[model samples]
Target: MKPILLLFIFVSTLFATQYSVIISKKVDVGTLSAQQVRDIFLQKRHSLGNQKIIPLNLVGQEPSRIAFETDVLGMGRDRLNTYWIKQHFQGITPPITQPSHESIKAFVQNVEGAIGYIPSSMVDNSVKVLYEF
Candidate 1:
């Protein structure tokens, strides 16, 4: 029975599809703590490890965006949207945006100081995982 219970927990964890925040290998800040990555993605910080950090994001309606907001930024979708909207009104556009995860990965690879998030399975050697939740 204990083995069955353990298996149940493990399987549930897997199905939860834990998401990860990732960056390009070229940006050598090393793995970021959850809070540090949160600050960067939320646009609260401009630099990390001597590199001027530029946070990239998926489209507003994308599912991964919600997962990233909840898991990494600790904000609800509505609150995040409001936050960005206010930034936009204040003439500060939110981090660079991409239409899809692939585009985000591509942009981060080509640009220095760029960071973004995607599903764990989608990540590859080209990008490095900074944090996971």
Candidate 2:
């Protein structure tokens, strides 16, 4: 019974959700490698050719944010926090944050260079998906 229960939980977790990295439709980027996406979010690479990239983040400790940091940024919470702290003194800062996925979509829709991550279900014709995982 315990084995069956554990299997059920694991399967549910695997299929429960998906994530997407999105950008404004007007930005004109075709596709981005994971490295490029990571660079943009880390503020390591500020632009994609002629387009100025603006990374938007969800507010602290949000599950989607954690997934993004883990899957995309490849950093755990503590390490990422340490990174941002160091960047702060170097005149670099983390991305702008929105409280909810709805706000992320709205900002990306209205702002030309904006990019953010959100649950794949919330996506619509308003934004272009750059990457998904």
Candidate 3:
């Protein structure tokens, strides 16, 4: 294999494995099914149990934001933009959006019924990882 190709593969693999989302430690919810988590993130439904659900997102230009939309939300950029635009025209805004992972973490920690995604390594005792994938 070409050295340059191998180097590209190595760097991509390394970063890909390094991101994840976390929640408060007190959050008793176990590993959530992917679909349920998706629902919450999309605001398709509320309440992940008795706990009302509030989803948060990273800033618009962030790579992690793209990953969450494509990898987790399974929506392409165009489609998501259209969805949000329609929601706006309908007088409904999407979930709270933060400018960075750090802001997302702080918001999730401070707000009840809040859930957000960040790098996997960022997981700490202050938050629980509802899912990783």
Ranked candidates (lDDT, high to low):
2, 1, 3
Best by TM-score: 2
The C-alpha TM-scores of every prediction are 0.82, 0.90, 0.84
Q: lDDT for every model?
A: 0.82, 0.91, 0.80
Estimate the lDDT of model 3.
0.80
Q: What is the lDDT of residue 8 in candidate 2?
A: 100
Q: lDDT by residue for model 1 over 11-111, one digit each (tens)?
A: 99878876667777887767788889888877778897688988988877787888778877889988987998988877776788899888887887888
Report the lDDT of model 1 for residue 66.
Answer: 81
lDDT for each residue of candidate 3 in 6-66, tens digit (9 for 90 to 100): 9999999876755566666656677787788788777777886688777888766788888
Q: Pick the candidate with the highest lDDT.
A: 2
Off by over 4 Å in 3: 1-11, 89-91
Report the Cα RMSD per candidate: 2.8, 2.1, 2.4
Q: For model 2, how does the per-residue alpha-carbon lDDT over 11-115 read when each residue is reduced to its tens digit?
A: 998887898899998888887888999999999999878988889999989989998999889999999999999999999999999999999999999998999
- lDDT for model 2: 0.91
What's the C-alpha lDDT at position 82 in model 2? 97
Question: What is the descending TM-score order?
Answer: 2, 3, 1
**Candidate 1 lDDT score at position 61:** 72
Q: Give the lowest summed-lDDT range of ten residues in model 2.
A: 25-34
